[model samples]
Target chain A: MEKKIRVLVAKPGLDGHDRGAKIVARALRDAGMEVIYTGLHQTAEMVVETAIQEDVDVVGLSLLSGAHMTLFVDVARLIKKKGLDDVLIIGGGIIPEEDISKLHKEGIAGVFGPGTPCEDIIKFIKENVKR
Target chain B: MKDIAKKVLSGDSRAIARLITLAENNDPSANDSMKDIHPHTGKAHVIGITGVMGSGKSTLIYELTRLYRKQGKTVGIIAIDPTSPFSGGALLGDRVRMMELTMDEGVFIRSMGTRGMLGGLASAVYDVVEILDASGKDVVIVETVGVGQAEVDIIKIADTTLVIIVPGLGDSIQTLKAGVMEIADIYVVNKADRAGVEQTVAEVESLVDITCSEKERKTPILSTIAKHGEGVKELIIEIENHEKYLKKTKEFETKRRLRYEAELIEIIRKRLMNFIFDEEQFKDKVELLIDQISKKQIDPHSAAEEILSKILK
Candidate 1:
C-alpha cells in the first residue's frame, strides 16, 4: 500500500484565530493527505510533541498573533531538538518578508504569507516529504 | 527492524509512534517487529469508547485519562475520525480536545482516520492497540469514529466497551433499537447538565432490564457532565467493578481468547486474499473470467469453482 502523507496543522500561541489553520487543513485533506489540526492556543512544545506523536511528514504552524518569529521558530527548533529533523516544517500568517529567510535558517522549509494559495502549500508538501 | 522492537520494548516514544505508522501502512516489515513484541502485550486494559458525533466522547476520555493519570497509570489514546472516500484524506481534529495530554510524558496520543475501513474504526486499530500495550501503557483507549447504531465492532477489540449517549438527541424508541445499544458493557449518558438526563437514564435502565439475561450481569448506566468532570469518579469505579466481574467469572480470559481467535482469523484472511490478488497472472486470469461472466458465456459460480480447483490442485 502507498504511504499516506500525514500533516499536523497546528495553531501556536494564544491566538484564537484558527480560520487559516482550518482552511489549510481542509485543503490538504482535499488534496489527499491526513491532516491533524490541533486547534487554537497551542504552545511550541505542544506542536512539536504533536508532530512527533502523529509521525507527520509535515508540520504546518499557523499563528496570526504576530508571534510567528518566536512561536514558529520555537516549534521548528523543538521538533529538530527532539531528533525529528526529517519532518518538513512550514509556517503561515502575518509573516513579514524579512523574517522568511530567518525562518529558513531556523529550519522552516516554507513560509506562506497572507494571500498565498493553498495549492502551493499542498504541492510543496507533496514534493518535499522525506520517507 | 529488530532494533525497532527493542526500542518499542524500552518505550521509546518516537519508535512506538513510527512503528504504529508502519503497521497502519501495512508494510510487510512490521510483521517481524510485531512477532518480537507479541509477548510484551496483553497487559494494557483496552477500553473502547463510542458515541454519535457531539456526544462528548473525547471530553469523557480526556477526563478518564486525567483520573487514570492521577493514579500514575500510563495511557495511550487512539482517536479515530472518518476518512473521506472522495479525496482519500481526512481532517483529524480529535487533537483539538486532547492537546493538553501531549505535554505529559506518561500519555501517548495518536489521531487516525478510518481510511475506508467501516465499523467506525481504523483498520489498523488492533495492531495499534498491541503496539501501545507493548510500549508499557497501563491503559489504552480506542475512541471510534462517531457512529450511529451499527458500528459495533468495538466489542471484539475492547476488554471493556463504553457506549456514550447524551440527553435530548432522541428518545429510546428512536435511537436504541438495535446492534450498538446491545453491545455496551457500560452506558454513559454524557452531558448530564442537559434537559433530558432523567429520561435518558430511565430509558437505558429499562432497556438493560429487558435485554440482560438473569444469568448475566446487568449493564450499568451512569450520567455525567463530562466537560465539567461530574460523576466521572463513579464511572471509573464502575469500570473497575466490571473488570473485577470479568476476571471473577473467567470471562476476562474467555474474552481475550475470543479476541485472539478473531484476530488470527482476520490476519489469515487478509494474507490469503492479498496473496491471491497480488499475483498479476492470477489477476489477469480472474479478469478474463470476469469478462466471460460479464458476457453471459460463463456463470460466476463456475468461474469461482474453476479458480478454486486450480488453487487446490
Candidate 2:
C-alpha cells in the first residue's frame, strides 16, 4: 500500500474560528491524506504533542485570532524542539502579508491567508511533505 | 527492530508512534518488532467503545481515560474513523475531543482510518492494540467508528466492550435487534441527561432481561452524560467488575484463547492474500488466471485453487 500523507490541522490560541480549519481538513481528506484535527483553542504544547503522537507527515496550523506571530511560531518552535524535522509545517487563516516571511523563517513551509484556495494548500503539502 | 520494541517497552513516545505507523502502513519490517513485543502484550485491559455517530463515544472515552489517570493508570487510545472510499483518505477528528489528554505523558492517543476494512475498525487495529499493550498502558481503549447493527467486530478484540447509545435516536425496538445489542458487555446510555433518557434506559433494560435469560450473567445498563463527566466513575467500576467476572468465571483465559484464534486466522488470511496477489513470482500467473476467469474460461474457485496449489507446493 502507498503511504498516506498524514497532516495535523490545529487551531492554536484563543481562536474559535474553526470553519477555515475544518474546511482545510475536509480538503486534505478529499486530496487523499489522513488529517487529524485538534479543533480550536489548542496550546502549542498540545499541538506538538498531537503531532508527535500522530507521527504525521505534515502539520498545518490555522490561526485566525491575529495571534499568528506568537502562536504559529510557538507551535513551529515547539514542533522543531521536539525534533519532528521530517514533518512538513504549513499555516493558514487571517494573517497579514508581512508575517508570511517571518513564519517561513520560523519553519512554516507555507502560509495561506484568507481567500487562499484549499487546493493550493493541498498541493503544497503533497509537494513539500518531507515524509 | 528489536531495539524498537525495547524502546517501546520503556515507553519511548516516538518509537511507539513510529511502530504504530508502520503497523498501520503494513510495512514488512514491523513484523519482526511485533514478534518481539508479543510476549509483553495481554497485560492491559482492552476496552472497546462503539456507538452511532455523534453519540458521544469520544467524550465518553475522554472521561473514562481521565478517571483511569486519576487512579494512575496509563492509557493508550486508538480512535478509528472511516476512510473515504473515493479519496482513500480520512479525517481523524477524534483527537479534537481528546485534546486535554494530549500533553499528558501517561496518555498516548492515535487516530486511524479504516483503510477499506469494515467492522468499525482499521485493518491494523489488532496490531496497534498489541503495540500499545506492550508499551505499558494499563488501559487500552479502542473507540470504533460509529456503527450500526453489523459492526460487532469490537467484541473480537476487546476484553470488555461497551456499546454506547444516546436518547431520541430510536426507541425500545432498536435494542431488540440482533448483532450489536447482544455484543455489549455493558450498555452505556450516554447523554443521559437528555430528554427520553428514562425510556431509552427502560428499553435497554427490558432487552437485557429478555436476552440474557439464557446467559450466566445479565448485561448491565448504565446511564451517563459523558460531556459533563457524569456517571463516569460508576461506568469505570462496572468495567472493572466485568473484568473480574470474566476472571472469576475462568472466562478470561477462554476469551483470550478465542481471541488469539481469530487473530491467527486473520493473519493467515492476510498473508495468503498478499502472497497470492502481491508476490512477484506469481504475479503474472495470477493475472493470467484472472483473465481466464473473466473470459469464462475458468471459475474463481478454480483460480483460487490454482493459486493455493502453487502456495502449498
Candidate 3:
C-alpha cells in the first residue's frame, strides 16, 4: 500500500488562535494527507514530542503569538536534537516576512505566511516530503 | 530493521513510536520488526476502552494512566478516531485531551485513525499493542471512537474490554444492546457526578443480569467521575481483579490464542489481497472481470471462482 503522508499541525505557545491551524489541517486533509492537529497551547517540546510519537513526515507549527523565531526554532532544534532530521518542519500563522529566511536557517523547510495559498503548502509538502 | 526491533525491545521510546507508525502505514519493514518484537510481547495487559462520544473515555484514560503511573507501572495508549472516507484523513483529537501524559517518561500514547476500518479500530492496532507490550508497558489501553452497534472488534484484541457509559445521556441504555453490551469485561459508568447516576448504574446492572448466563462470570459495573479522578482507583483494582480472574480461569490463554488466530487470518488476508491486486496481469484480469460483471456478462461469484482457479493453476 502507498504510504499516506502524515503531518502534525500544531499551535505552539500560549496563543489561543487556532483558526489557521484548523484551516490548514482541514485543507491538508482535503488534499489526501493524514493530518494530526495538536490543539492550542503546545510548547516547542510538546510539538517535537508529538511529531516523534506520531512519526509525521511534516511538522507544521502555527503561531500567531509573534514568538515564531523562539517557538519555531525551539521545535526545530528539538527535532534535530532528537535525531529526526528527515522530518520536514514548516511554519505558518502571523510570522513576519523578515523572519522567514531566519526560520529556514533554523531548519524550517517552508514558511507559509498569511495570504499564501494552502495549495502551495500542500504542494510543497508533496514535493519535499522524504518518502 | 533488526536495529529498530532491538531498540523497540530495549524500550527505546523513539524507536517504539516510529515502528508503530510503520505498522499503522503497513510499511514493509514493520513485518520484520514485529516478528522480532513478538517474542517479548504478551507481558502487558491489553485494555480496550470503548464508549459513546462525551462518555469521557479520554479523560478516563488520562486518569487511569496517572493512577498506573503512580503505581510505578508504565502505560501505552492507542486512541482511535475515524478517518474521513472522502480524503482518507483524520483529525485524531484524542491526543488533545491526553496531552499532559506526553511529558511523562513512563507513558507512551499514540493516536490512530480508523482509516476506514470497521469495528472502530485501526487495522494496525493489534500490532501496535504488541509493540507496546514488548516495550515493557505494564498496561496497554486501546481507546476506540465512540461507536454504535457492531464495533465489538476490540474484544478480539483486548485481554480486558471496558465499555464506558455516562449518566443523563438519555440513550445511555441503548448502548447496552446486544453486540456492544456483550463485549464488556467491565462496564464503567463515568460522569458519576452527573444527575441520574444511580438510575444509570441500575439500568446497566439489570441489563447485565438479563444478558449474561448464570454460569458466566458476572460482569461488574463501576462508576467514576473520571475527570476528577473519583472512583478511578477502584476501577483500576477491578481491572486487576478481572485480569486475575482471566488467568485463574485460563481465559487469558484462550483469549490470547483466539487473538493470535484472528491476527494470523488478518495478516494472511491482507497479504493475499495485496498479492492478488499488486500483480499487473491479475489486476487487469480483475478489472476485465469487473467490467464483465457490470455488463451482466458474468457474475461476481463466477468471476471470483475463475480467478481462484487461475491462482490455483
Candidate 4:
C-alpha cells in the first residue's frame, strides 16, 4: 500500500488558542494525510522529538504567539541537528511579511499568515513532500 | 521491518529516538520499521494520564514513572501538549517537570503536541504506544494536555486512565463533571501538600459514589504530592490493581479488541478519503468547487454531493 503523508501540526510557545490549528489538522486529514497535532504550549525540543517519533513527511507549525522568530528558528535548527533536513518545515500564523524572508532563510519552505487558504497550504506540502 | 526496528527492540536508545522521529515525521521508512516490530508489541501496559492545565498532571506522571523504574522496568512516556493555531509552532514545555528522568536508562520520554487535533491525544499516539510496546518497555505512560473535551479522547487510547486534580481550582469536581470525571479509571488528588486536599478528595469520593454502579468497581481516589514524589507507590499499586481487574474480568481482551476495531476503521477511512481526493481528475474538480464555495456561488453540501456523485459514476 502507498504510504500516506504524515504531517505534524505543532503549536509552539505560550499561545493557547488552537481553533485554527484544529481546523488545519482536520483539513490535512481530510486531504488524505495523517496529521499529529501537538496541542498547545509546545517547546522546540518537544516538536522535534514528535517529528522524529511520528516520522512525519512534513512539520507544519502554527504559531500565533508572535514568538515565531525565535520558536520557528529553533525548531528548524533542531530538525537539521537531528538530520531531518529532508522533512519539509512549513508555518502559519500572524507572521508579518517582513519576517517571511528571514524564516525562509532559516530553511522554512513556506509561511502562510492569516487568510491563507487551507488548500494552498495542502498544495504546497503535496508539491514539496519528498516521496 | 527495517533494521532500525530491530535495533530499537534491542534497547538502542539512539535508534529508538531516531525511529520515533521518523515515525513522527511519517517517513516511509517508519512503516517498514513498524511492520518489523509489530509482532513484538502487546506486552506493555498502556496508561494514560490527563487533567486540566495547572492540575499537576506532568508531576504525577513523572512520579509514577519513577516508581515503575524502581522495579527495574523500562518505561516510555508520551507527553501531549497543544500546538498554536496561527503559527503551527509548539513549545512542548512539559519536559521540564521530567528533567530528573532524562538520564535514566530505564526511561524514554517523548513529548508530542496536539499538533492541531482538538483532543489532547494525537492520532499517531496509538501507533507510538504500539512502537513503545514493541520496544520491550514494560509500561507506556501517555500524558495529555489538560483540556476538557480533548482529555476525553485519552480514555479511548489508554488501558488505564488517570485524571489528576489539584486543590484550589474552584469547583474542580464541576469541571470534571464536564467530561473527564466519567472516563477516569483512577483519580489522583495531586499537589496534596497544598490546601483543599481533603475537600477535593471528599468531592471526588461523593461523585464516584453517585456515578458508579454497584456492580461496577469503585474508583479509588489517591492523593499524591507529585513534586516531592510522595504517595507514588500507592498509586502504582492502584494501577496494577486496575490491570489485574481487567485481566480477571476478561475486560483486557475486550479492550484490545475494541482498540483494534477503532484502528482498523480509522485506517480504512483515511485510505478511502485519500483515494477519493488524490485522484488526479478529482483535483481540478475539487479546486473549482472550493473556488465556487469561497465565492458563495454554491453551498458546501452540494459541492460535496457533486464530488461524490462523480466518484460514484
Candidate 5:
C-alpha cells in the first residue's frame, strides 16, 4: 500500500489551549492523513525530535500564545540542522498576518491563520509535500 | 542503499525513522535494508502492552519507558491507533502521554495508525520493531490500540505481553472472559488508586490460578496506579522476571519464530496481492468478471476459476 501522508500536529510552548490544535489535527486526519498529535506544552526540540522519529512529511505547529515566531523558527531550524530538508514545516493558530511572512522567510512552507479552511491546509500539504 | 542500512545498524535515529517509512510503504529497497538489519536485531527485548480504551495503557507505557531510561537502557515505543474507516485518517493521541520522554535522547517514540490492518497492530509494526531493535534500543515496546475481543496479534510480536486493566470498570473479570485475557503474559491492574483495586486483582489472580494451576510458570498479576507511578517499580520487576523466565525456558526463541513466520506470511500475501492486481490486464479481467457476476451472467466461482487459470498458466 502507498504510504499515507504522515503529519505531526504539535502544540509548541506553554500554551495550554489545544482546541484549535485538536480541531486541525482531526481535520487533517479526516482528510486521509495519519496525524500524530503531541498534546499541550511541547518545546521546539521535542517537536523536532518527534518529527524525526515519526519520519513525518510535514510538521504542523499550532500555537495561539503569540510565540509563533520563535517556536516556529526554532522547530524549522532544528529540522534543518538535523538534515531533514525534505520535511515540510507549516504553522497555524493565531499567527498574525505579519508574522506569516516572517515565518515564510524562516523556512515555513505555509501558514494558516484563524478561519483558514482545513481543506486549504490539506491541499497545500498534498501539493507541496516532498514525499 | 547500503548506507541507509549501515546508518540504521550504527543506531542513527534519522536512518532508523526513514527506514521504517520505507518498510511501511513496502519499498523494495527496504527489503534489502532489512537483510542487513536482521543480523543486528534479536538484542532488544520486545514488549507488548494492550488493554481496553481508557485503561491507562498509555500512561503505564510512559512510566515504564521512564523506568527503563533510569536503568540506562535505551527504549523505543510504537503506539498504534485505529484508522478511521470512513476517512482513512486517525488521531494517534498516545504521544500525549509519553510527551515527557520526547526530549530524552535515549527514548524514541513513534505513533502509528493501524492503516486498516487486522489483529490490532499496524502491518508495518514488525519492521518497525526490527528497525528499533537494530537501532540499539535495549527495549522496544509495542502499544496496541485499545482493542476489544480477539486482537491477539500482539502475542505474535511481544516477548512479554502486559494486559492492562483498571478498577471500577464493572465486573472486570466478566469483561476479560471475552478471549482477550488469554494472551496476557502479565496482568497489570492499572489505575489501582481507584475503587475496587483489590477486587480486580483478586479476580485476575483467581482466573490465572484456575487457568494455569497445572502449569509450571504461573502468570503473575500486578497492580499499579500508573498516574502517580505507584507500584510501577514492582511491575517492572515482574516484567524483567518474565523476560528471564522466557529465556530460561527457551520460549523466547519460540516467540521469535512465531513472529518471523507471521511476518513472512504477511509479506508474501501482500506481494502476491500487489503482483496480481498491479497488472492492468488482470485488473480489467477482474472488473469484467465483477460486472458479469453483478448482472448474473457469470457465477462468482467461475470467475474466480478463470482468474486462477490465468495465473496458473
Candidate 6:
C-alpha cells in the first residue's frame, strides 16, 4: 500500500497567528497527506515528540515569531538526539534568506518563506521524504 | 512485540521512547508492539489539560507532575503545538514551560506538534496514551495547543479533560463559548489571583448551568493560580472525583469503546486509501483524471465516479 505521507505542522514559540498554518494544513490534506496541526505556542521538545508520536514523515515548523533561530535549531537538535534524522525537518514563515543556510546547516531540510505556494511544499515533501 | 513490550513494562525509558516514535511514525513494527502492549494498558489514568495561549497550562502540569512524583507515580505528558505552514518548520516552545519536569526521573514529557491536524492532537495520540499506560505510568497528561475548537479533540481520548482558563483577559469567557465549554470535564480558572477571578468563575458557572442537566454531574469549576501553585490540590481532587464518577457510571468503558471504534474506522479508511493509491493501474487512471480535470475536460465529480467504478471492478 502506498501510505499517505504524514506531516506534523507545528507553531513554536509565542506566535499566535495561525492563518498560514491552517491553510498549509488544508492544502496538505487536499494533497492526500495526513497532516496534524499542532496549535500555537509550542516548544521544540513538543514538536519533536509530536513528530515521533505521530510517526510523521515530515515535521514542518511555522515560525513568524522571530525566535525561529533558537526554536528551529532546538527542534532539529532534539530530533537528531532522538535519532529521527530520517524525518524531514522543514521550516516556513518570515525566515530571512541569510538564516536559511544556517537553518539547513542545523539539520532543517528546507525553508519556505512568504509567498511560497502550498504545492511547492507538498511536492518537496513528496520528493524528500525517505518513506 | 514480546521483547519491546517486556522492556516497556519493565520501565525501560529508551524502549518506551523508541516505541512511541515508531508508533507515531506508523512504522511497520508498531502494530505488533501495540498488540503486545494492549492488555497491559488501562491501568494508567489519562488526563488532558488544555487552554488558550498564555494560560500557564505547562506550569500547572509541571506542578501537578511533581505532586504525582512525590507520591512515587510515573507521569507522561504530551504537549501539542501548531506547525508553521510556509517554512515547514516548527518552534515547539512549550517544553520550555515544562523544563523542570524533563530531568525528573519519575516524569516523561513529550511535546507534540499539531502538525496541521485540526483537533489539537495527533492521530497517534491514542496509541501514545496506551503506550504510556502500558509502560507503568500511573498518570498520563495530554496537553493540547488550546486554540479553542481544536482542543475539543481531547474529549475523545482523555479519561478526564481539564479546561484551564485564566482570568484578566477581557473576553476570555466569551471565547469559551463553543467547542471548548462542551467538552470540559472540569474547568480550572487558573491565574485566579491575577484578577476578575470571581467574574470568571461566575461566568463559567452560568454557562455550565445552561449547558449541563441536573441529572448529569456538574462540571466542577475550580480556581487556581498555577504559577504560585495555589489551589492545585483542590483541582487534583476534582479530577479524581471526575474519574471516580466516570468509573461508577460505567462511562469509562463506553468512552474507551467509542475510542476503539473510532480507531478501527480511521485505520480501515487509511488502509483503503493506501490500497487505492497503490494500485498501478489506478494511479494511471488518477493521473489521467487529473489531466482531464486540469484541462477542464471532466468535472471532479465525474472523475471521482470513474475512479470509484474502476475500484469497484
Q: For model 6, how does the per-residue alpha-carbon lDDT over B1-313 read when each residue is reduced to its tens digit?
A: 4697789888766678667777655667878888998999898889988888888888899889877788788898887767555543444456556655644667776655554467777767888888888888899999888666555777778889888888766654584567876788888999887768898888888888777766579888999888788888888788889889999998999888877776776567655665677667677778888999999999999999988887688
Residue pairs in clash, model 1: none
Ignoring the other chain, what TM-score does chain B have in each prediction? 0.93, 0.94, 0.94, 0.91, 0.94, 0.90
The sequence of per-residue lDDT tens digits that candidate 3 reaches over residues B278-299 is: 8786999999999999999999
Error of 2 at A11 (Å): 0.6
Query: Which candidate number would show the highest DockQ if scored against the true structure?
Result: 1
> Can you write out model 2's per-residue Cα lDDT over B204-284, one digit (the tens) per residue?
989988989899989999999999999999999999999999999988988788778878877787777777778899999
TM-score of each: 0.95, 0.95, 0.96, 0.70, 0.95, 0.70
Pairs in steric clash, model 2 = none
Worst 10 residues of 5 chain A by lDDT: A93-102
Point out the higher-scoring one by lDDT: 2 or 5: 2
**Cα lDDT tens digits for candidate 5, B30-51:** 9899998898889999999999
**Per-prediction DockQ, in order?**
0.86, 0.81, 0.70, 0.07, 0.84, 0.07
Q: Quote the lDDT for A80 in model 4.
A: 90
The CAPRI class of candidate 6 is incorrect
Q: Report the C-alpha lDDT of model 1 over B1-313, residue by residue, as the tens digit.
A: 4999999999988999999999888788889999999999999988999999999999999999999999999999999999999999999988788777989999999999997778898888888999999999999999999998899888888999999999887877954587888888899999998898898899988898888857479999989999999989999998899888988998999889877876787677666666667667588888899999999999999999988787778
User: For candidate 4, what is the DockQ-based docking class?
Assistant: incorrect
lDDT of predicted model 6: 0.79
* TM-score of chain A as modeled in candidate 2: 0.97
RMSD of each: 2.0, 1.9, 1.7, 8.5, 1.8, 7.7
- Residue-level lDDT tens digits of model 3 in A1-131: 65888899998899998888888888998888888877888888888888878888999999888999888999999999989978999989887778889999999999988888899999999999986
Global fold similarity of model 1 (TM-score): 0.95
Q: Please give fnat for model 3.
A: 0.59
Candidate 4, residues B4-93, lDDT tens digits: the string is 888988977667766766665555667788788888888999998988898888888888888888788889999887765654545455
Predicted model with the maximum lDDT: 2
